[model samples]
Structures are given as structure tokens and as C-alpha cells.
Target: MASTRIGRHVKAPRATVYRLLLDADAVARWQVPTGMTSQVHEFDPREGGAFRISLTYDEPTDTGKTTAQTDTFHGRFVRLVPDAQVVEVVEFETDDPAVTGEMTITIDLADADGGTRISAVHDGLPDGVSLEDNELGWRISLGKLAALAETGELP
Candidate 1:
């Protein structure tokens, strides 16, 4: 199994960050690429609750066609510490059954000089997955999160 961890400090309060994390609409607003679309199939922010996100990547190709793909993720919240941390167990689903594994994601928040320090750890990642891609996605998502918390707008 592979593991990936990423962290960033955002200029926002812990409570504000936590609220943005729990809000499904807010998640949809910032969880995808700049021009792509994201949909939340199910979301429950509390412990033991389930959540799923469908991300559609729409990019125009040189052949005048649009390359689009949708990835669905299913996960359940394992633990929740209000304004502090959240843990979730997640699984990725694809047509290939072999591409399956469990990932435990931990999001920790703390007070910083300008705002909050956010740390994320994604453990138990599958061997076949690309760590760089995962890290980049998280980086973008976290950047969006910071923007949302600070400006109340999706980046």
C-alpha cells in the first residue's frame, strides 16, 4: 500500500474551515478543476455518515471533441472532532474491480498566525495509483478550500 500526506496553512479560522468541509454545496463548489464540474451524490458530515463525489473532467481535444470522464468515490466518516479534525475511510470504484482499496483520510486543523494550519494524510492508497496526481489534486482542493473560507467564493 502507498500513503500520501499534504499540508497547507490557510488564512481562515478553524471553525470556518470545518464548516466548509461539512457543507456539501460548498464542497461541490471547490472540489474540481477550475473549469470542470463536480456533483455530490451523497453527503453526511457526521461520524459514521457516508459521502460520495462525482468529478467530471471536461477538456476540449484537438480533434474538436471533448474528453470527459467521471470518477465516483464512496466513503464514510470514521471520526469527527468539531473544528479540529476528521477521519474518513474511503474506497474508489471503477469498471476494473482490481483497482480497489481502502484509504483512511485524516484532516487536521490548528490555529496559525494568519489563519489555520491544515494537514491531510491519505493512507492505505493502492499501489497502482499515482501519488503525484493525488498530491496535486489535494493541493488544488485545499487551495480552493482556503479561498472559500476566506472569500466565500470558489477558486
Candidate 2:
């Protein structure tokens, strides 16, 4: 298993960022990487709540974990602290053994100079997932999140 940590500073208040983190609609808008669209099949904003989402590539040439052009994932909220932190246990919806595993994602928010500082930790990456690709995807997604948070508009 592998792990990664990513950090970013958003020019928005922690409360605003936190709200976006828990909002299913907002997630669909900002949680996706560039060239991909996200669909939230289910979401429940509370500890122990379960959620399912899918990300589809705009270009069919891209490979997918769940299908030819999409990657689906389902998870449960392990912990939730209003405006502070969120932890989730996620698993890819796939039959490929190399990608089968439970991953833990933790997001921590803190007040920063005139904004919020976001710390994201992703652990338990399966062997099939490339670290560089995962980091790039997260950087893209977090950039979208920052844009949305700073402008209050979908990116």
C-alpha cells in the first residue's frame, strides 16, 4: 500500500470550504479532475453515512477503473467534525485485484492568513494506482475546489 499528502491554501474562509466539502452538489462540481465530470449517486453528510460517486472521462480514450470511461467509488464517512475535519473509507468499484482495497482519505481544515489551509491525506493506495497520477489528479481537483471556494461559483 502507498500513501500521499497534499496541501493547499484557499482564499476563502474555513466555514465556506467546509460547507463545500460536505455538499454533494458542490462536490460534483469541484471534486473532479480536469477533463472529467463527476456524478454523486448518493451522499449523506454525517458520520457513518455512506456515499457513492462516479467520475467519467470526457475523452473515451482514457482508461477507467470501473468501466471503459468511468471510475466509480463508494465509501462511508468515518468521522466528521464541523469546519475542522472529515475522514472517509473508500473503495474502488472494480474487479481488478490490483486495485481492490480500502483507502482512507482525511481532510483537515484550519484558519490561515486571510483564508483557510487545507491538508489532505490519502492512505492505502492499491498497487494499480500510480502515485504520480493520483497526486496530479488531486492537484487538479483541489485547484477546482479552491476556485469554487474563492469565487463561490462552480469551476
Residue 36 displacement in candidate 2 (angstroms): 0.8
Estimate every model's Cα lDDT from 0 to 1: 0.82, 0.95
Give me the displacement of residue 132 in model 2, in angstroms. Answer: 0.5
lDDT of 1 by residue, 89-117 (tens): 98876645444778899999999987999
Give me the runs in candidate 1 sitting further than 4 Å from their true place.
60-68
Who wins the TM-score comparison? 2
Q: Which residue pairs show collisions in model 1?
A: none
Provide backbone clash counts, one per model.
0, 0
Give me the runs in candidate 2 sitting further than 4 Å from their true place. Answer: none
Please state every model's RMSD to the true fold in angstroms: 3.5, 0.8
